[model samples]
Target: MDDEVTTPDGLRLAVVQRGDRSGPTVVAVHGYPDDRHVWDGVADVLAGSGHHVVTYDVRGHGRSDSPPGRAGYDLELLAADLRAVCDAVSPDRPVHLLAHDWGGCQAWHAVTGDALAGRVASLTSISGPCLDHVGLFLRRRSPRDLPAVLRQALHSWYTLAFRLPVLPELLWRSGTLPGALVRRERVPRPSTRDGLRGLELYRRNMARGLGRPEPRHTGVPVQVLVPLRDAYVTPALAVSATTFADDVAVRYLPGGHWVVRQRPELVARCVAEHVAAAEGDPGTEAPALRRARARGAALAAEGGRAGPASRWSGALAVVTGAGSGIGRATAQELADRGARVVVVDLDPAGAAETAGAIARRHGRHRAVAEILDVADDAAVAALATRVATEHGVPDLVVNNAGIAVAGPFADTGADEWRRIVDVNLWGVVHGCRHFGELMRSHGEGGHLVNVASAAAYLPSRVLPAYSTTKAAVLMLSECLRAELADDGIGVTALCPGFVNTPITTHARFAGADDAEQETRRRAAAAAYTRRGYSPERVARRLLRAVEKNLPLAPVTAEAHAGLLASRLSPTLTRALARVEPR
Candidate 1:
């Protein structure tokens, strides 16, 4: 349906509505130099999903009636126009807002001021920052934030050009401006009239709004989509909404300013998810939204930073082999950093112990224990499904389950080799295959950490079976990293040297009698203890590896040294493999 919405200032705005009228209303507003057509792609998706999606041109754009002068483009009047449209479309209920660029700016003004008070349920702002928020961000600048501010200034060089007297208008009239936009932003050819009149937005509002920004706050749940590749707005500025809104979630997308046109389905999906979450729908709480709430509460208490309390705050993590050693320590470490951890292990008692410790330290909901043998592909797949259904998709998965088999290649039988490979190598494969699929399907990026060993790169005759399995895991991580890069999933292989853990005591020794096996276990365990590297240290490195998205992380001095030696002199490493340690 097409209609004319009259603003309080007596201007007729061009409006179009789609989908069933009885459904929840979603008012999508377009940016500068673009008409309601910019939202055609997004509207089609939202309307098909059973939303009453509305798109409209502002006062002086498209088929809308233009006011006499620049004063008509004031933010206050634009906000009033938005309010009038919302009242005309859905008077009885609060409507969700989808806005981009200048439209986002006006929507922010409406939600913050009394223009649309109690009328907006939520707002999704794309590639736009509230000028007041930007002003305050600049006013409260610290030395550390200067680099980000400078980067934003560089991105916003065109705003200065827009403020020029006649150049922008001349360019718009000459076909050069539309050509530049279509070539650079990959947007459809914009109407020249809309392009010419929208320049008033920059000239009329920019200086006044930014020079003296008011304190703007809103109770509406706001989702800011910060396009990392946007030429007009930097992520730092786009996320400044967190400082103003009571409920704000910032999602960093891998696209440019016109992402709505480029990836309409993805943008529409995000919008629907945010709207559903605002409507209190079950299972609609994404990890980013949860983190935003947690951060908002924390900021309310401390009046501190605007971002997450910790990088892992409100993140969901799955750590396998959490019965003890590196896995247990990693679960605890992630819990300490504010991540909810699912502690998985083959031993039920160990998993419970780790969960209990985490619950006592953080809270009861921070940990869940599951018993699963990672080598079993079906079991791993089942666990992945349960975790996603119950706790949402995990942001991090650590494949740390493994068994050690130290023996000469000649003495190691097929059964022994199979056992070690299944536990050490296939365990990682199972975790990655199942959880990685979940992450990809969820459309949210995550990280996978596969724990290999220094034995992966260090050739050792006594540890031939163990070395082969670890080497396979290392190569698998590298290959998976390359494969999943486009899907926004990161893969890491953690190689640690002799950490003081229980693996040595449980390792199988081929061709050894029971007494001799016991003696070898005792000797290996003691040697590892003497080396004195702790699993906690390895756990810390694991966190760093995830944060940095490192492809290969070598933990402990000997691990680093072994990796360096393997690269520098394969001859020397092979020669050392011939000697048996006493």
Candidate 2:
């Protein structure tokens, strides 16, 4: 049953207490930018099994009191509210606390203190920080303040404008909120229904406690479920949280912070396993739980990008076409993440510029820019041999070198077609033929990433040659992946949309002059070119795919939509494709 409770301070909290009135109890906390619905799935599972599950809208969220002012809006206040709820909800039994995102920080505070720590049976911190690896996070993001800092860097104007009180009010009224919402059932429209209170909570939290580090653990048994694609918290934090507490269980989920909505089953199972172990069920394996416990403590030692476990330290990765494109973007991302990169490009100045920028950003030896034409098989072969000897099988090989040419088949000459095929298609072939063998002979395993395009399957008549070459590259990569799977080497075919890159300047049109053609084609093509994401986005997604051992990476709206539509009906796809707007 749901009820409203007014605290001593006059803040009204919406509380959800369901299941048999007499049963074991659990408390679920939600972090910033969200509400208590984050625990709806886990609560349901627990309730069905006769556990008294408790959830409430954190202050300033979900019809909770948005107490005006930053004075009472920090972690301390959040923790106080939690303790009060504990006293009010389940004073008899030791409560099992489940927290995610920022709520995990409050859990760290609530479950660690003497009184609550002893009464709490177990604590699960999902995708929040215990700040055990600050040095590593600082290094990963050169300038520091990785999470909110990166958001500020990305959304500069929002930071400047959102701080003004009542400013979001005007924008919220402009229909910007509803347009931003794609699915109303799950995702609320802009500002959202039952959302302003949450926004106010976030506003005060950010305004007052932006720089405060999360409080350390209360020494309770903690289980940390880290999402592989979390943008705010680093994996280093999840792995390191165990350093402070002796019993920490680390698990990986295959979703975003919105896993409550995206992969509820996975989240529910993880919660079940953690609860089973805590409850000391004879059916659960204790030794295996200990192994999981050890991972939260020492996996950082195994996967640390900087500390002693940095085997890839100073190792060189050869990246081709390293200019102001995906090549440059990947070079920066790798360098930032700790890897020696050999920037290869036909443009000496361009390569030098990229290397210089990377060095400036990361404050290390980012890359050695070498001018070369990858299409020339001998040049690429020699470069591979040099890179192998220079840096042991080039731990990672990203074949992101390619060119694009677009025109009607009538206007495109054999020369134009062959040039595109030579660079886009054969370049990948050269990379595989040479690097694949070098890697197999070198050691345990390595990753080979090939950059294809969405045009491969979702064919585009406007870009015939480029699409054909990309299609060939996609097929080649899949074949290589199957062939190499047994040899301990992994292959990933990356098919991204029209990323915002310089190549868009050459994109063609049917019959107009260059100026008019660009103007006409710019809108649809501009989807990824103007407000479109950077090559860094694709690079990040590619790295994540490699970590998860994914075979194909389709990285764009058109790519994902086409795949979904085709999977639904291929022949019907052809019919629908004819009607799709250009």
Candidate 3:
């Protein structure tokens, strides 16, 4: 349904409503030079999920009527316009507010000031901050925050240009402004009036609030979706906003100012999660919402520096083959450090056990289990989709599934080689291909840890199949790291030597009789047990490698020595490969 709502100042605003009116109402607001249609993708998504979605054009943009003078576009009047729409849409109930750019600026004023007080249940701000907060942030900036402040100032050059007298109006009227927006934002060419009338937003409201900023605060839960690549608003502004909000959650994404157009599904998912959490229904809360609640307040309040540990405090991680050995240990290590973990394994019972242990240690929702054979491309794709749909895009992905096969190349059968290669090499391939796509699609950078092995460079003739697969994995990691570097995604190859694990007991000894195979398995397991290295130690090293973004890491002392020897003394390594194990 489309209707016209007149604000207190006599400006008529265009409003569109969708979904059942009986459901929770959500009001979405757009920024300058854009209309309610900017939220078309997000609105349909939320509406499909049973929420009553509302999007309105700001005064002086889209179908809304522009007021006569600069005084009409003041933040106070703009806030009143927001209130008017909220009142018309949900007269008896509070509405969840989602806004971008200028709309977010006005929404911040309304939510923080006395205008909408209890009328706004929650706010999900995208690429915008309150002008007063920005003012206070600049004033309070120390040497540590100077660079970020300056960077933000540089990004705000357009704002200063907009304040210039007739130049901005001329650019808009000549279609130059609209062309730029079309090129950059991929949005439909906006009306010239959108640009010309919106100039007052910068002229009247920008500099006025910087001089005598009020101590504005909001009790409403706030989720800030920061586009890290936004040309106008720095992510630092989102972090700074924590000071004024009682409860705040900050998520960093990878997009420019117009992410709503570039990645609309991601925007919708984030907004839905925030609204669901604010509604006080835990059952309806998404993983992102749960993580946000767990993250608590921003780090700025405590005066602590932010890093992977702090950033991933409440983030989600997905680990494959997390049933036993290094996989299980890595899953436990991550969960203990405050990340919600998804434990995936081929064995259903093993996966459930890992999940149960994590849940018992952390909260019940901190860990979940999924059964999968990582070699299955379709299955891996489905898992990736399900995780993104249910848990949001994972912040870290560990492709740790593998199998062990031991024997000389001449004795190993084709079937044995295929079995080992399928699980060891193809498993990692499936995980990376599917989950990596999800990370890229979400427009948020993530980490991928592929578990290779020390045999990758050790040059073992007896362990032909095993070493070949591990070597391929190592090479794959290097290639992926180079490819994804520009996108902020990090890929690492984790190589661990002999460590006490169940892999030895389950390893296949090609060309051996049944009795001899069992004997070899037992002997291999005993060798690993005597080595005294543990899977937990390897797991810890894996975490560090990811945190540091190491391209290639060799865990055990032997692994490190082998890597050095492979590079510095290849002749010696090749000579050693000819020596057969007893």
- lDDT for 343 (candidate 3): 98
The predicted structure with the larger TM-score, 1 or 3, is 1
What is the Cα-based TM-score of model 3?
A: 0.80
Cα shift from native, residue 246, model 1 (Å)? 1.8
Candidate 2 stretches with Cα past 4 Å from truth are: 21-23, 112-115, 130-164, 175-186, 190-194, 207-215, 231-240, 281-283, 286-291, 300-582
Clashing pairs for predicted structure model 3, backbone only = none
User: Over the stretch 484-556, how does candidate 3's per-residue lDDT look in tens digits?
Assistant: 8756688999999999988998898888999999999999999999998998999889988987889999999
Root-mean-square deviation (CA) per prediction: 2.8, 17.2, 4.7
Pairs with steric clashes in candidate 1: none
Please identify model 1 stretches exceeding 4 Å from their true place.
165-186, 189-193, 228-231, 280-288, 295-310, 568-579
Per lDDT, the best of the predicted structures is 1
Candidate 2, run of 10 with poorest lDDT: 304-313
Please report, as a residue range, the 10-residue window in candidate 1 with the lowest summed lDDT: 299-308
Question: How far in Å is the alpha carbon of 137 misplaced in model 1?
Answer: 2.1
TM-score of each: 0.91, 0.49, 0.80
